[model samples]
Target: MTNQDSKVLRRNLLAGSAAVLAAPAIVGTALAQDKVTWKVQSHWPKASGSFNDSLVALAKELDTRTGGRFKLETFGAGEIAKDREIYNIVRRGVVPMGTISPAYILGEAQAMGLFYGVPGTLRETWEMLQLTKNLGIEKLVNDELAPKGVVMKAEKAYPTEVVLRRKIASAADLGSLKIRSAGTMLEYLAAAGASPQQIAGPEIYQAISTGVVDGAHWGAAIGALSMKFWEVARFHMKPALGITNDAWIMNKAALDKLPADLKLQFLSLLEERYFLRSVEYLQQEAIALNTGKAKMNVEVVRWPDDVLKKFAEASTGILKKEEAKGEISAKGTKALIKLMTDLGYV
Candidate 1:
């Protein structure tokens, strides 16, 4: 074969090999006479790549791992319960498994949001994993789910940053600006002089577009892309404030009902799948937002060191004040700060 023909054949061979490597378990499972299936649901729409993409891959992985005997039929946001309702729905065993932002239900367990997104918390995936492992928060957090007949199997961090339509060159720019924020972030934004308005994630885009809100402090790249916030917001800020933890939880009753072997297999697969998909999610989001902004002509702004320092100082003070006021318990606040400090994030 000519050199060009040889290269084409080699490329095709590699692609074929990769497909087999990625899917060996599926082919094996199709041949199995005995197997089980799982019904998994999520609280995010299929359009958001992070939530749906992870679910789809997880389903495929489970199918492969169990030689097709175990499979997940996944549903996107609102297909089962509305986003806000997914947590209770899953906890009540309305669904076998449901993916959700555990932090969203902090009222149910005050520690949830603090563990989910403590300002100046984990930035990178590895650092996040380390914190989860070392802080003993993972078990404590998961235990809280057990009582609801849900077992939090996996958690992954998504970088959350501040995005503004108006340029924020310094702390002064935040003065009196009404920023859409949630939970602890509300305090952080307020400390910066931006009046934090409590709005649902879905409402942020319209609020910003219609001038109902000045800006939103939410997910870094993926959330920005999924919400199409860039269309209305001209500026994307750098130096992310923190990360949010999204979890995949299995209904404990459903898991208890599973055959022991299958349960173990599922747990193992869930863990691996979460780690793999989380990495892919962050990378994909980073690419999409970074490239998408250039195409859309949105300016990505980096805060000056002095500006970032001011934010950190003010946010730290706000956290301390809240802890003292019992807004967040002292134990929760101390544990979180200790974890962040140990991880070198603070």
Candidate 2:
């Protein structure tokens, strides 16, 4: 064929191919949306509790709200992946989403943990919410997750309270006790005159029951109920040192594929659920504290102003050290301090 004829034939073929592909695109877009199955795992057990329960509930809500367009298959604690490995698993897309402790992975994203709990930093759940949204803490968390190919859908703060086998009302009371603490709480407790050790969530019950440690600090409402903490310790302290923040994370690639409206709806569901559950969970925990249904009998104690002041001082020192070590970004630290000052906590 002549050169001009050859070019004309190629153009016609390309047009026909484009039309064929466009037919399916139009049909698929009209069929509601693409159905995607995503697997989610949590750091908590399958049992109905905070971390795991929240994961399952969120998954169910997502499936329901999306009319089953998106399916999330959830694995309970240690079912498919261990709690400690959830971050790597989600990052690699082994699971599309999972529940993770931002603080637990601080070594990966130093600023992420600081956004959650930093003893004396955010004393209450309300303060935590404000700090998270104020400094764009949620976005900071999302940005950190991006490098790992994960995006945080929701972050929930566990109603915090310190648990001790013995009564501890003063900094002096802490000197004799060995405690199991995690993240910044470890350092804060250590500086508060207690010997603090780092331990995992699943190990706390056995660790305390066996006297492997004197006392351990975990969640107040959720931990108290899930671990049967009352059976192991005599006292459930009021106004725990700090709440544990767990993030519901999704694989960034997976999140990117959802319809734009679906993505917005899904995230809105998470935000609404986070606020509602936190309030309800704290209230449920209060009821549990009053009923005293925990396996072992225990008394509830409250930290005095003097001891709290000591804790705050120690926490401040730890925060400064973390900043010096470059574990927490200067930006995050400054934003946190500003929030604390505005709230009159600093």
**Top candidate by lDDT:** 2
Instruction: TM-score for candidate 2, please give it.
Output: 0.84
Task: Write one digit per residue (lDDT tens) for candidate 2, span 1-346.
Answer: 9999999999999999999989988887876676778777777665437655577677788889888887778777777776558888888888878887776776766676665567767767776766676567677666766877878744576655777788866778778888887777777777778888877677777898999887776667557666776677767776677755777877788788777867787778888887777677778777767667453466777776777778778887867865664534666777878888897976
Model 2: lowest-lDDT 10 consecutive positions? 44-53
Q: Clashing residue pairs in candidate 2, if any?
A: 161-240, 231-296, 234-298, 234-299
Candidate 1 error regions (>4 Å): 1-37, 304-310, 317-346
Q: What is the clash count for each candidate, in the order shown?
A: 5, 4
User: How close is each model in CA RMSD to the real structure?
Assistant: 13.5, 5.7
lDDT of 1 by residue, 43-154 (tens): 6666666655677877877788777778888887777775457777777878888887755666655456555666655567665655554655456666666777877754
Model 1: per-residue Cα lDDT at residue 267: 82
